[model samples]
Target: MNLDSFEQLAQRRKTVKVLAQDSLPTADCRAVVQRVIAAAGWAPFHKICSADHRVEEQFSGIEPWRFHAIDADACRNLRSHVVHREAAGKIPAMLASADAMIMATWLPNLPAGGLGTASDNESFEPTLGNVEHIAAASAAVQSLLLAATAAGFETYWSSGGVLRSRELFDLLNIPTQQRLLGAIFLFPGNVTKSDKVEIAESKLRAERRPASQWSRWVEVKQ
Candidate 1:
């Protein structure tokens, strides 16, 4: 995408807090959720097999954190676990009630004996078969995100929770061979900076690495 297009999408996509007080209409929410999913369905992705992979059904009254468990498990498998901070059954709603939602999960048919590094270090390299599959899955999710933004919705991708939990993979009915890629949440809310809530300064700021750190990895030829 062009810089102008990327900036517009980035500005529109904000990570809104899934406040307990805020609520979304069930029926309307479901419709867009389906659309976001359908868009991903239309995107091209690797055809990986899942011996036991299954996503939870759409059930009313399910909370947001429950969905977080699934995300949690996925992250754990990838050696990037997020600390659990809430009870079960509280996550689905956060997803269902969102303005829109997007997800990147391993579909059935992934090649057997997926790849991984000795440790989490140097694990991002695509040489490992599974890692390469995940990279492809992420690309597909990016398509879904951009499509949602183009359609006028805010979006954010989260691989923090489920990238590593094997049990979660089992619960989601995902086959032992398949892996969960990522999840994205989208909202119809406005993205202006003025509407943001102030955070306590006591919170530790996240450190960002400069792009130069990875410049050597990029192939540049004169």
Candidate 2:
């Protein structure tokens, strides 16, 4: 795509918190999800290790993270435990109306000196060693969002608290070594021109400073 087209796509991409009244077409939702995730996998990652290792093996390899897609039924079942009454009440309708919810997780890399058979959470350290992997996972999430926007789908990246709970990890059978980054909600609705202003206003979207404000070209002086 040309520069203008690319710019348009970037500008067109917006976080869709509130979905439209209609639900996504079930028949095509899976295909759309697959395409977006495939695009996410294409993100440039620093692959320091292989992912095809056994559970017993020490996971020292730094590979791209994994994404899990949860359907409406499962989302509803999980949302039942939401503490906030208003949020809980809104979840079913929101989840039912969306195409799917995608969970992004950071895989833990086992240290060389094996920590025995202890759980991942107990053994793993969120230090500089795994920082690159976390950055790669964030890139993957961005790619997925861009791909969904290009495919005429609205997307929302939410932590939602529920996804981070221990209950969710157990329910999803996610390993303790893996850390959930956040959840992405995919909707079928396209934000119209008229609705764009309203949505932007509702969120009080922050103004971003120009590159001049954040960028630097400097020489070190001690």
Candidate 3:
């Protein structure tokens, strides 16, 4: 890939959703995920993530983002767990079709020893650090998305419905202080585009207006 193709690659990226059951899951896309995650490290971040939290000990202090990737077997286990919980709405279909799932999380700078006291949604108190952390993580996620796109894969960034639960955190061995940024699901491009599987494109993609409509130059005050 060349710098000139960056615009084309960006344009080629789109949200493709596949709801197939255990079809493309047979492919091990973790290598693509690993390379893309390394590419994601190149994303810009204004603030360095704190490694003081027990959850962040494994990674560099500079990265606010932490990715936990699960393979097909793990996906199947998670699928079973979700089904057993009776909250398996669209999750099972996604997991079944995914070659792998990335549980992307961001470390939040919180009050000292405040993990015990969390909101109803298990989120921490907002801080300037929290905002930057999310931004950095989101940029990293976008880099991964584009990398996956370049690798001939279809990706879905989901809001992680039941995946944000405390039980899941414990099951996945994720620290409680980390917050979910995205539940990235990867599918084989061929399978996703094939007539054999049912695929759904994000309707919001077509609804996007031109850049001029959503962006503008800042006015200068004399």
**Top lDDT prediction, candidate number:** 3
TM-score of each: 0.50, 0.73, 0.89
Report the Cα lDDT for candidate 1. Answer: 0.43
Model 3 misplacement above 4 A: 1-4, 22-25, 54-57, 119-121, 192-196, 219-222
Clashing pairs in 3: none
Cα lDDT of model 3 by residue, 1-222, tens digit: 687799899988899888865445476667777898789778888787765554334665568888888887788778878865656577777777787788999978767866546543366657888898899999999998998888888889998888988888889987777889989987778873455567888989999999999999999999
Candidate 1 per-residue lDDT over residues 20-110, each given as its tens digit: 2223343245555556555654444443423323343432211111122223223222222122433323234344334543334543233
At residue 31, candidate 1 shows an lDDT of 52
lDDT of 2: 0.65
| lDDT score at residue 14, model 3, on the 0-100 scale | 90
Residue 166 accuracy (lDDT) in model 2: 57
lDDT of 3: 0.80
Pick by TM-score: 2 or 3, better one: 3
Which residue pairs of candidate 2 clash?
59-110
